[model samples]
Every structure is written in structure tokens, then in C-alpha cells.
Target: MTSSSTQHRPPIGIITTLRSSLPFLFFLLLLLYLISTSKLLIYPPHITTKITCQDSNLTTTNNHPKTGYDTELKHIAFCIAASSKLWKSRKEYIKLWWRPGETRGAVWLDNQVKIKKNETLPDIHISQDTSRFPYTNRQGHRSAIRISRIVSEALRLESDDVRWFVMGDDDTVFVVENVVRVLNKYNHNQFYYIGSSSESHFQNIFFSYSMAYGGGGFAISYPLVKELAKMQDRCIKRYPGLYGSDDRMQACMAELNVPLTKEPGFHQNDVYGNLLGLLSGHPVTPLVSLHHFDVIDPIFPGMKRVESIKHLLESTKYDSGSLIQQSICYDMKREWSVLVSWGFAIQIMRGILSPRELEIPSRTFINWYKVLDFTAYAFNTRPVTGHPCQKPFVFYINSTRYDELRGQIIGIYTVHRERHPRCRWKMESPEKIHTVVVLKQEDPDRWLRAPRKDCCRVLPSRKEGIMYLWVGHCGENEVIEV
Candidate 1:
């Protein structure tokens, strides 16, 4: 009789069931969040483990004040990746230049490098996992795969002891002291990925603008390193078509929502030319590392690449000061102008220049009220070692007349020098006169009035197939190569 009266119960609505469980779900998630943030301590008491080097010579400094902050608390591990092809030169260079006494490092190899049994190297060895990638040996794609494996291995080693994981090519030069100093600026407890772009915009276009060009080397904080190691194998597998370790690393970072934090001290040297064009002007930042010495000459003046590097190391020994004062100057063939009051060279492109003066000492000192595209422009400073311009040439284009000379190359050079230089103003037009003046010791009128003067002519138009920034009217030799 009860069965006859049995009625089908109304089906429970999904929304109603979800709503009923919401409180419990929320509480669970909140607990996880708290634990993840280390707010709710569920784990056992953490032991403050001190990192000790296996070698007595390797002393890990925990805190040093002169670096402007405490950095000894963190340990930096370097993973210098190398190919067997470059084994001889790179291994020797590492032994000669790289000082691993303060930090931990290892050389990752794709193949075994033959070295004398007595010869001590930075524990150089190839990846034990011979699982071959689709990419051929020495190809950048394969290099990227190897780097992922290297990073995975590095993370597995003494997890708590490693605060930072640095990756560099065999040719890369690391100023460990400066690297430590720069790392000190950021909290090691947080996730950080530091690097810079290649000097070549084309390479960036082909690969990725966000990537820290591998040549300049890069650093990953311990927290980020752990996160990366988890997904690295999967990430590498996905980027089968990508090239360059840096580019692939960037792609993986994108998936993890990590951005490249640019540090100017890391020189990609993607551009072709003497670095004098770059390093000369007093760079305000400290020089942390320089890469691609294989392509260009070394940074230090007047020595072979290796010797120059050694010389640089000696000069900055125990010194945490900035490499340059931000007065660095480089040459460009593009249209340029000078700011009279403030010492700056304004390169004229499609963008308009700000009429006002920005700052003295160097452009790096003052924030640009308006972007004038001044990096390519040259100031009074000479990056060239021998010809150090004591009283550098400075000039200004009339901003009111900027429209008239929008795309014209302007060159300024030291004609002759006096201890206390006088600024010279030359008016080229009446409505908005184009002006030129020296920066440092200024008496503009006196120099213009002087019959005998150093002459520079930035022609209004290009001649034949070539354009010239004529400095002293003496044929091609006097022509300043933009």
C-alpha cells in the first residue's frame, strides 16, 4: 500500500547543491591560501640551514655592508652552459676569470670535454639524461632543451641553499660582485627573472622582445626557479619550433606570468661595433656583466678581449661603485641635436624634441619631461679611451626651428679647447634661429665671434650616395661618422 503511494522526489538542482556547498568550498580554499602564503603554519619548525661550500676556499659571505645592502644571506648558483665545440677556450677562460670562491657554479655540457686529469674545472659535465631532443646538436633549439634540463638539475641541488640561479653562455663574463650587489636590491623571498634585450631589434622581432638575450646572461630567483623546474620539461616539449635558449625561456615564463625585469648592466652586445660607442659615455649604472666578446672587442680599453676583461676585474676588485657616471656617448648617423643648458645629444627621428633643458652632469640624472629619443645622440663625452674629450663639444638646435631641420643630421666636435670654455651661439635664421653652443664652460658669443674657430657642418641634404657630418673641412678624414 505504501509502494502505491510512493512518488518521485523532485531532482536536486545543480545550482542549489552548489550553493549549499559554497561555504565548505570557500573554507577549504581559504585554508589552502593561508598555508600557501605561509600564514597558517601547518609544517614543522623550519631549520635555519647555513650553506657551506664543499671546498674550503669557497667561502659564502652572508652579509656585507659595502654592497650598500646585505647580500651574504643569499647564495647565488651559476650554471654556465657550454658546448663541447667551445670546450677548450671557454673552460680556460672560466678558470682564469670566473671566481667561484664566493658562490656555487657548475658548467653544463652537451658532450664530454677532454681535460687533463690534474686540470681543475668548474665541475664540467654533460646532462646524464641522454633522452635526445628533436633538435640537432649545437643548434639553439637543442641548447634551449639542454638549458631546461640544466635548470631542472640546478633546482634539485641544495634547494634551501640556493637563493638565485644564474644562466650564462660559456663566453659570458660575470662580475660576481656586481651581480651580488644588484641581486641585493631585490628580496630573495620573491619571484624574479632578470635579463635584457639583444641590441638588435631584428633579433627581438624574430624571437621575442620580452626575452633576456641569453648572451647577456640572466638570473632567476629561487622561488621562481622552483616554479620553473616544475613545468620546464613540459614547457620545452611544447616549444619544439622555438630557437635560442633565451627565447624558449621567455615563452615558458609567459605561460607562468613572469616578466623580464631589465637590468642595463647586462650587455647583450647584439650590435656590431666597438663598445666604445656604448661604454664610453659615463653609464650611471654599475657594470654587472658583459656578453658577446666573441663578436666585439672587450670593454676595457687597449687590451685583447681576455686581457681586457682581467684588467677590468682588477680595477673593480672589492669596489661596488658604479661603472660610469651616465655621461656615456656613442655615435650615430641619424639626425641629431644638442640641448644647450643641459648636456645632451638629441637624435631626431619621427618623434619631436622637447624645447626645454632636462639636466646637467648627464641625461641619466634627470627624468625626461618629454621623450626626445636621446640615447643615440652624442654628448660632450668621448667613450674612446685615448681621445678623452676634456672639454667636449656641445650644441643646440633651435626648437622653434625644429620643423625646418626635422630630419637633418647635426654634428658637434671640439674645435680647440680652453680650460674655462666659453659658449658660442650662431644664429642661422631670424624667425627661429638654429643655435649651437658648448655645454660645460659656456661663453657662447666669444666662440662665435672668434675668427679662428673649430668648424662643423651638418649639411641640410644628403650628397651622392653618402651623407657626411663634416667636422674641420679636411676631406673624408674630418667627416665625423655620424
Candidate 2:
């Protein structure tokens, strides 16, 4: 009964099986090693059809340039986001800044806008449909997803020789030359998200401090825009809960690891009422853009909103670098503190005010959050001087021109109001000075170097009713003093 030798062979000893097949195992391992090293022609794995991963480096440019680079209007592509219905009225604001045959980019509307023939504006383009993009924000419109795509859209439209892609709302007003100046400071070949946050403290807190409010406008370097375009749609898909375009763009910026390169010049104007106080105390930076014209009083006190913006542009043309530049000087003999917001407004206070105190904005404009909530403003704001004696004698620009003969800029600012309360403590009142003649030497290169508030000196004038003031670079040791 040798049942076929019941040969289990003692179930092959653990090490014996390996020892017996050592050569085969070694051969198999060797084959695998060779295959891994590509030394053997192995069978190809099945070619799976899948979505291609984005090549981030495809559009990345050299962050640093070796040669001199100057950014110009031609180098920037502006993508203005607007509601199709609002385009008619808002185009006036855009026309104030957009120079036809010079400026590039388009106005991205949610739908086609009925632009008039020969309208002085950028090309109007209906924005690509964004209905497929999920937007779960309970309070915000889905247009946010559309507006957030503007930079990417503009990038695709004008990729060649474009250094920056500037984005804003149709109501946004840009000092285009100054926009060039600000963009020039950074290497556009690098990843840069340049703009200021919302003027409203609550708006910034609600959205993000790093976001560049779209109403105010923001600039994205060409390289950054290209990279953003690569993933913007996907990025928007991920951020379905964002409240606005700026926040969504900011979210994508976060993904790209780029922080907001804040240029305080961009004004979100997240406030209401007169903008006089805000513009008067502007920071000593180029005034690149102004937004929220639809919500606030005209920048200049006495003119229509569009006309006022154009008047400001009139001054900007002669000296965009110095426009809204706050140059504080004093008529010490008269005991008056004169603040010449060059190309903007003039504020004459009855008493000597230290520059430190006057630099903070006066709360003339209504805060977006709450008029009474002093904490609602993003920056410091002193309450409007209810005391007539301490209040400023306001003046707005009447006209501006490049005095070709003098090779400088001449700005005329007249009293915004007819009369004011009599100041008891005044050495000599500004009331007699019917007009302020501001003469500024054209220093196109002013912002090219370091930035400081230009100095204003009250110059003698033979005319009885007019006061003459000169604004320019202060002397080596000059300081704004009382």
C-alpha cells in the first residue's frame, strides 16, 4: 500500500525551497532590476487616458531681469469687469483713464454690452459663461467667479509683450501713468499681486486682509497671470464659497504662495459721501487708482462725478506722479497750516497743525460699515472738526494745465464753499485768498527714486485775491514744519 509513496516530501522545508530555487529567484530579481533600470525591453503597461496634469513651469518667466526694464501703458493689459447693464454709465469712468490706440485689454462684461460707435474705451468683451462653476456663497452673486477669471482671460488675450494684467471694475478710475509707475517698481516677470485692501475695516476682516479690492483695482504680473490662468478655473471650483472676486483671486494667490504686494496708492474707497477728506490725506505714494465713484460724492466737491474725475485726470496728465501728493507747509507768519494735496485739493487750517496730526484722514466720507463706528475704517481717521475754528478751509481744483512756457504744471484751486465761520485766533485768514495757484515743476522722475511728500512753499504774489504756492522737491534739510 505504498500509496504513490504518499510523497509530500515532508512539505518541503522552509529554507530548502528557497535554497533549491535560489538561481530562479535571483534571475527573477535581476530581470526586475534590469526592467526598472530600462536595460530590458519589457512589455508596456496599458496607456491610461486621464486628464493631463498642468505644467506650471510652462509659463513661468525669469523672476529677475538682467537688463533695464521700463513698464509702459502698452505693457499693461487692463481687464475691467462690469455688469452688462451698468456698462453704459460706468464707461464714462473708464473713458477718463483708458487711452484709445494706446492702452490694451478689454472690459469683461457678464453679457454683451451695447457699446456706442467710436466710444473711447477698451474693447468690450462678453465674459465667458461661468454657470458651471459652483458658487455656494449664500450672500454673494456668482459674478464673483466671472470677475475672478478676468486676469486669466486678459492674459490669454494679450500674452505677448505684456508685463502686467491690471484688473478693476468699470466704475474704477485709474491714474494709468501712475499705474505704470507702480508696476515698474516690481519685476513683472516675477509673481507679484499688487494692490491695497478695502478701505472698510470690516470689509477687510470679512474677506481677507491680503486681498486687493477689485473696485479699487489690482495688478498681476504677466508671469503670475499666466500661472494663475493655468489653474484659475479649478481654483474657482475649489473656492465656491468666496464672497467676491477679490477674495477668490486672493485665494488663488494664496495657492500660488504670493502675498499681496500692497501699494497703498490703490484706493478701494469702501466708504460713502465726500471723498475730499480721504483724498486730501492720501499717503505719500502715487495715487494709482480710485474706486467706488458710484457710491461716494464726486472727488472734487462742486463738480459732477464724471467731470470731477476728468478734472483730476487733467491734473494727472501734467503730473500723475505728484497727483494727490500731500505736500505740507505752513504760513508760519500767518499761523496757518496749509496742506497742498498737489493736483487735488488744498486745506488751510486756522491754527498751526503738526504734520503728524494732519496726515491722518478726516472722516468726511461716510464709513461703509457704520458712520459712528470709528473702528470701521481701515486707517486712522480723526472725526470731522465740528469746531469751525479748527476745521479746514476747503478748496478744490478748478483747472490744471502744463504751462508749456514755464515747463511746469499750473493748478488752480478755488474755494469749495462761498464762506466759512470767522476764526477768532487767526493771524490772517485764508478767506481773502480767493484762489490758490499751485505751481509745480514737472518732475516726471520724482517717483523713480525714493518717495517723500513734496514740500510746498507759499510764494509772494502781487495779486491781492490770489495766493501762489510752489510744490517740488524740498531742500536737502527741509522738513514739513509748523
- Deviation in angstroms for 404 in model 2? 3.5
How would you encode candidate 2's per-residue C-alpha lDDT over 1-482 as one tens digit per residue? 35564654455586688799999999999999877544111111221121121323221123423323677889998988989878778888888888889999988888876667887888878788889999998999998888898788777679788898889899998888888888888888789999998888988888889888888889998888889989888888998988989999999999989999999999888898988788888987888898888888877766799998888888766777888888888887778889888877898888888888888888888788656787898899888987768778878888887655546666888887756766676367777776887777676776655566777887655566577777776766666754
Cα lDDT of model 1 by residue, 283-400, tens digit: 3455667777776655433458777666545534322332321221122333233222122222211111222211122322111122333443323322211222222333221111
Q: Which stretches of candidate 1 lie over 4 Å from their true place?
A: 1-69, 117-120, 130-132, 136-141, 300-302, 326-482
* C-alpha lDDT of residue 465 in model 1: 20
What does the lDDT come to for candidate 1?
0.52
Instruction: Give the worst 10-residue stretch by lDDT in candidate 1.
Output: 396-405
Candidate achieving the largest TM-score: 2
Worst 10 residues of 2 by lDDT: 39-48
Residue 280 displacement (Å), model 1: 1.6
TM-score of model number 2: 0.83
* TM-score, every prediction: 0.54, 0.83
